[model samples]
Target: MKKLPIILSLLFLTLCCVSCKVGRFVYYNLANITDYKIFPSRPLVNDSIVFHYYTTEQDKAKVPKKINYNGSEVAFDDFLADNKTVAFLIIKNDTIQYEKYFNGYEQESIIASFSMAKSVTSILIGCALDDGFIKSVDEPVVNYVPELKDNGLEKVTIKHLLQMSSGIKCEESYINPFGDAATYYYGTDLRKALSKMKPEREPGTEFSYSSCDTQLLGLVLERSLKGETITEYLDEKIWKPLGMEYDASWSLDREKNGLEKTFCCINARARDFSKIGRLYLNKGNWNGKQIVSENWVEESTKPDTGLGNVDYYKYQWWLSSGGSYMAKGLLGQFIYVYPSKDLIIVRLGKNYGEVAWPELLTSLAENY
Candidate 1:
């Protein structure tokens, strides 16, 4: 009978070990959701978290017969069902051919953009430069945020931040509880968290993807615009000018800062997000207006670094195989553009676990 106790202990240990490994794969940290304090609140649009609204503008483009893609084939409906993808909009040539929302998602629901907002911020930066609000990406970041002038950040260039090449002391290991990503999200003052960082390497010497880099860029943009908010800049440059049907909102820190330009939580309609892709595909032109310089658009989408080519990040967009670029966010948010193919696809979802967003995107692109 003494073996009974040992057997029970062994069973408990086995169960604990099994749960830990399974939890690692299925559990979502979702620290940003909690850290941002985005409790259940009124959405900017409709009540749902995913929806679509067709623009009044007539469709002026054609649909492609077939899409080019790499990797294995996947059924669109099956993927949507299995992944719990909140929304999907496929624009081929120029007309939207396929759009669906699952799991009670509906039109006018403003799903959070997460990291996709970074690419949107990049577009706004291009507009700010074109309009002479900021002279160039080569300008020292401290020129705008004078508080950073004497700090080590003074040496960091705007381009460096955009390309995620800022050699700041940042570690983005999401799994590590003590890592910068978790600490930054959990902290009340994200900028204060950044302020505490001492440079571990020279600015722009190495490539390291850091959400703080984009947040700092947000601060710089706000400073350049004379304390104008990022939402204000976006409204002027893209949202209102592009004829966005409804108001979009950004969740901010405790200070009510409107410049959470990175790390997500942008609440906007699916169509509005799709417009961003269309704008890039059209080379920054919107309704006969040069919203952003074509030169900037071209340069911002091309691969800039040589460290690795598997996924080349340009500005805030990621360049994939076959001249495709996209703004991708955690949990499957995407704003993909293929200028050569004249295609754009915007997918928003909460598939943090149990789904392959990249693979699903590849499937959509293949069917395009």
Candidate 2:
């Protein structure tokens, strides 16, 4: 009888809170892999003309049977299994060398991209540039979003947001129920969350990784579009052109007429995710066609040590210490690319576990 009263109290409080972002966060608990089902999504329907890459399992490269990890040696297959990986793929020369799925996950199972969507957003930004929807990266963000002038964001640039040096004030903690990440993830109105944005310091002053930068970029992308949503733009430019094997969807802030959570939440299959790797591996050229400018692809992945920028990251893509880069996300999701060896590694997991994947991937690339 006492527990019933407590439960009813929580229910009443949840029903009464404005927006209910906090209540939704508590109700859903922490973010998980299958979030696609919990949230309504904008469909990313693939092209009718699909591109399929054949697999050559027998011609797979030799990987160490026993892998060394954080000073301890473990069986190579067991290592990925123990880390709760749902999908793992190693592609060489435009073919699948190794593919595995575990923990009730299959090849066709849909997996949420988490922050890997940031990299996809970066690609869309490049397309926006090519199509003349956006003039240049150096332009002040306020040119696209004048309403943010009073918020002290007039000095911020599109490049600044891409580089994560926008100096936007946001609490990035996923554990905090009141934090910006949780609110953005669970909130019904993304524009409402964006309207409350406040700057903490001068943009381009220091390197700071904030989801607010990416979310703001989404709004800019949204505003720049003529007669479409970001999801429609993605479908027309990337998904349909690239010929994705399956239909995917971008999760929205609401079930109907909502903006894409571009900072995260692109739900897709494993092989289809690898196609993104193949695109960049070919330097944004799919077959003989140029999907994005070659210069844009180079700038997006290459290290930049300029002021207020990081050599380890550029244009929402993470650069390795070596000649490799990745589209990384929360919970250890990765689209690691090693161009020197023509290798691409996709690892999607419940958590990253003990491995520092960037370093490990660098070492793994050396063998190829």
Clashes per candidate (backbone, < 3 Å): 5, 0
The local lDDT score (0 to 100) that residue 180 gets in candidate 1 is 71
Reference-based lDDT, residue 127, model 1: 82
lDDT tens digits, residues 39-124, model 1?
Answer: 22222332232223333232443323333234535565555655667787777655667677777777667677778888988887
Shift of residue 9 alpha carbon in model 1, Å: 27
User: Residue 222 CA error for candidate 1 (Å)?
Assistant: 0.7
* Global Cα lDDT for candidate 2: 0.89
TM-score per candidate, chains pooled: 0.78, 0.95
- Over 251-328, each residue of candidate 2 has an lDDT whose tens digit, in order, gives 999977799999999999998998898899999999989999999999999887786887889999999856899999
lDDT of 1 at 114: 77
List per-prediction Cα lDDT, in the order shown: 0.68, 0.89
Off-target runs (Cα >4 Å) in candidate 2 are: 1-8, 11-19
Model 1 earns a TM-score of 0.78
